[model samples]
Target: MNWPQSFIKPKYLSLTYLLSLFLTLFFLSCEINYDGDERLLVTGRILNENNLPIPNQDVEFWIYKGSGAGGDDDLISLTATDNNGQFLMLIPSPNNEDGFELKISDPDTIYQHKILHRILDKNFTNYEYNIGDIVLYQHHVITNAYITFNKTTVNTSLMDVKFKGDADYLVWINEPETYYGDYEPTLAHDYYKNVPLNSTLTITYTIRDNSTETLSTHEATVTINNENLEYIINY
Candidate 1:
């Protein structure tokens, strides 16, 4: 004997199926919602105290424990600040409570001084951060070196040069070889090392500009192995 279809199916089974389908579609069409609260989105522009946008800055947000989600470990990572110092990021789920960190640095010398700090905010877009201008301090040389050589040996020593500026810098030294006892250009845009006795050697050092897209140049000359060589730089 076969069971009747109506007897096998619950009276409200069809209605239940339709209701579930409707709910799923509705939720999918709408924005995120949980625990009776709607999702929140925030964004904003980053600017320095000088009113210029701090390009290439890093911006990140984290969770706040007291606000509900526990702490930083539960935080989400966001994108870096754009060339215009603008950024966008999603808020956390559940409590949606969070904080953020802003970091700005020099592209050239990552080791140079930097600005970093944490900001406590529930809404990032609603807030405007006025980070001050990132001023890079100049480097100063504490000591200078001048190397000379004689037959059978090389001379190493320091020279006292008065630099009339407040700066921190790196010094590079080079020894060029020449055919005569006087420093001269033996190669175009190139210099050689090591020379025989009676050949002149030109030793020079120059300071370099420690910045992005720029370089500092200086040169000096000295006699070595009876040759004088010309170099475009000395430190």
Candidate 2:
């Protein structure tokens, strides 16, 4: 049984050609991406100061290009938290020199806005990033006031308090009308009352010594809105 060399060579060459074609197609399939850039997954939860989940809040992702003089932010994705205060977002792969910023805000005006600057570094390609829990503080119209006295103070009792604003505007204080200090001035007093949003609040207080002598008089003004406010008075 003798086979011709010419026939064997043709069959071997044909098999080699078919094998090369199959390998080329397999590699091409592996490298092709039909959906464009690779996607990066991000997950997080939103909570309030009370440690309760905040649902239905808007979460935003911003991508920036360049730096300093020519940098600009581009809104990439917008998503909302679920009932459990959880959110997931898919971000496309960024360039080697791009930056990322994340922001979340309550739509019901109950919590203050929160912003996380530069959460993602540059050249963060297709990868998952977990931000865990982000807590927002409650918005308050009133500010808490703490008053302290220096070692040279004689009297430590508030005698008179005055509010200068519209006559129709009502000023309220959660603490006692008059605060009397013993050895140390009360530093944890909540005297400032909440005012209507977007209003100007001015408070004046007179403190006297134990012998009925006026120790000091002080005044402070703040523009009240949806942000947290705290005032400290050192006599």
- Top lDDT hit: 2
Given candidate 2, what's the lDDT at residue 141?
A: 33
lDDT of 1 by residue, 1-235 (tens): 8999888886657888879988877544342223334334546565543356656655454433332232223335456667876766655443433334433344544222232323544323433334333332311211222233222212222222222221122211111122222322221222333332332333433222333323333334433333333333322
Judged by whole-model lDDT over C-alpha atoms, candidate 2 comes out at 0.61
What is the TM-score (0 to 1) of candidate 1? 0.28
Q: What is the TM-score of each candidate against the true structure?
A: 0.28, 0.44
Off by over 4 Å in 2: 1-35, 67-69, 122-126, 141-235
lDDT of 2 at 184: 36
- Where does candidate 1 have its weakest 10-residue lDDT segment? 166-175
- Relative to the unseen true structure, what is the C-alpha lDDT of residue 16 in candidate 2, on a scale of 0 to 100? 78
Q: On a 0 to 100 scale, what is the lDDT of residue 191 in model 2?
A: 48
Clashes of each: 25, 1
